[model samples]
Target: MQPTEQPTKTESLKVAVVGTGYVGMGTAVMLASLGHQVVGIDIDQNKIEMLRRGELPIYEPGLEDLLRASQERLRWTGDYASAIPDADVIFICVGTPPLPSGQPNLRYVAEAAQSVARNLNGKLQVVVNKSTVPVGTGDWVSRILEDHALDYSAGRYVVVSNPEFLREGTALHDSLYPDRIVLGSSSPEGIERLRQLYQPLLEQTFTPPEGMPRPANYTLPELVTTSLSSAEMIKYAANAFLALKISFANEIAGLCECVDADIEQVTHGIGCDQRIGHRFLSAGAGWGGSCFGKDTAALINTGSEYGYTMPILRAAVEVNQRQRHLVISKLQRHLHRLQGKRVAVLGMAFKPNTDDLRDAPAHDCIARLMDLGAKVTVHDPVAMPHARREWAHLTYDEAPTAEAALRGADAVILMTEWDEYRALDWDQAVRTMRRRLIIDTRNVLQQLPQHSTVEQVGRTTLHNVPGNEVLAEALA
Candidate 1:
């Protein structure tokens, strides 16, 4: 069969996206909204039912409305067999979480591939690995499929490595207007088939969002055909570079503290250089999303496998780990002793806009403070429930607002850079708290109020009180 001609925007193809987590759900909703019939399969029945009712299993800004509108073209199922056989293209978006030793466990991907292979009776199907896997994962998936079934060459079943780069909050928007779509496949037929799958997106035929520029039709670049190994490397390299930028800024922030130089101004001056663009230069409590840490570490481990060392990448990881300690040190300076000091943590989620709290620096900060004997009360706009479940020993505030968490607190530490916390009424919170002390880890307070006291890591001075005299006095 001549590879099906690249379909027009109106022409829809059957697409199956396995795993209904953030990446999978966003992909399914976006493709369905673009006119393709999408079946989102997951083992979790609860998640499937939630998606069936147009409810998003995760908290994303514009996802629920898009899912609701695209309900006609989208379906959710817990049964993988029912979804995989009819799918012209199957996207595996399952998690590839890191083990304790920092190696990616590809158990989910292997299982998904085996399931797809078992159900493939004799139809042509393109399997796209949307999850960020280690190098040569596409070949591993192909091998697993071959082992599961009768003799099948690369023609009947094609595995493509197409990594996703959607941010948690703006996943749908990013999908609709991707910076670029990368399709990594060696087989000519596989490349052509995947191109046809994403042709609607490339042709700019989907309805453009209001006030957004219509995407120009750029001739699709031959699907970026390459060996499976190179394709896997592309995903890791991109994320590692971004993570490196963030760590570099934080390291500069430390320098700013030592020399009393403003890191923000320094970043602004350096960012003007076009070669060093100002993307992830904002210094804060470091990156704690699902992608950067895991992908970067996987890259480092992959280096170990090849008998090479990623010294800079390893330093990036160390700098990120020390960032949380920097916040704790600032707190220690203020209270003199963490024991018996009430620390109100302002945010629990990693960054903002979404409810995911995986590997949040706030957890590290809280645990350290607790170990030092600080009473912790935490609050988040949407992540309170998750935090409560994760850190059950800590106190939780029912009020969704920040002030409620600040009430009766000795000091407040801003961990996550949430917009709501940035817009907090400083004066009111200061009046309510026992001590007017704050450790703005995110450097988001804009201007410190004159009536209140505030100290930012790598910015403010911890003077006026005894350096270690306060702690000595407490001990005496």
Candidate 2:
């Protein structure tokens, strides 16, 4: 291959992004917006058609506008073979959802890699693993390509692990202005090609990083390069530490309940520490969403595979699971029996912004409450459709807002921390509800109205009842 001049703004390269889910679509849209000709390939025909029509399959903020703007640059298709052959880089962004046994199901990723392997036309293509996979997966992909092909050259394909650290709702912003672009490849040429591809970002040419207030994009000095394993570990380690912080806060909240100390005050005092940053320190219903739980679990499982035990991570997972029950325990104390109680759940999606319900704590809470005989009415900003489909037996409400779900409820539980739910008219909701009982599971309601009965897991009142003591008292 001849050395080509550095890509200019007008120049466009053919890029194929396999898997049109959150990560894949966000990448395709961002690359296309940056003047790269991107073809998004997915098995879902409906999703491809939606993308082709400039309609995003997922609910990502600011994505549709970008997709609309990049009309000529971005295209969608279900054909993977054709897309792979005509691409400079093919990114595998398929899902690696965890199995029931807490192991990552990499079937989708392996299948995608195999498909790329089968269509190797001896052209120099950089196969990047955009999906979050286990360590040594890059090596596995390289071997898969070498094993499957009838005729394969030594440097025909270079495997790189460019794990994505995108938050669901603000994925587009995260893509355009990422905290750090990590490129992992053993080959020097592979690294240079990726660097060239992301040169615009590194130079801050296309999008200026100075004084950018995009919530998702935190500007950095330069891209970070490392070995394939280190890059993969960076993703898992970052997520694990964040999950640990959340679980740590929850554990501290439990202790605050024991000694009549308010968890909010405790977190504030400790969060000011520079080393122990205050990013994920908010004590809540528990951490959920696509990343934390699964990644942490995968890390633990990875540790076990190597005959090492991750006790702290195991405890984090346990605490997370227990935090959901903590909400239930609070409700059981106030209402005595959940059977036949008209309970309203404020949010269904794990966190807010995106409609992703994978491993959402609300599901576990709703299922447990239903088993205990509570008639649950759930509502979310954008996840109602997904929730309804997942939990068919439960009733769903699509009112103008959260107040509709809170109306005529025995008690309301704030499951997901949506911004709308945070700024809700508590007084109006208290008055409209059949009962004034409110369990602030996410610790969102820092200040409670005088009229309404508000109970949080880690806060204390002048009445002197500690949160944990109250739980212990109830259990005793």
**What lDDT tens digits, residue by residue, belong to model 1 across residues 398-419?**
4557887788889999988888
Any runs in candidate 2 off by more than 4 Å, and if so which? 1-11, 207-221, 393-400, 461-476
lDDT of 2 by residue, 344-396 (tens): 88888877788888888888888888789888777788988776677677544
Residue 182 lDDT (model 1)? 79
- Model 1: which residue pairs collide? none
The TM-score of candidate 2 is 0.91
Task: Report the Cα lDDT for candidate 1.
Answer: 0.80
RMSD of 2: 5.4
TM-score of each: 0.91, 0.91
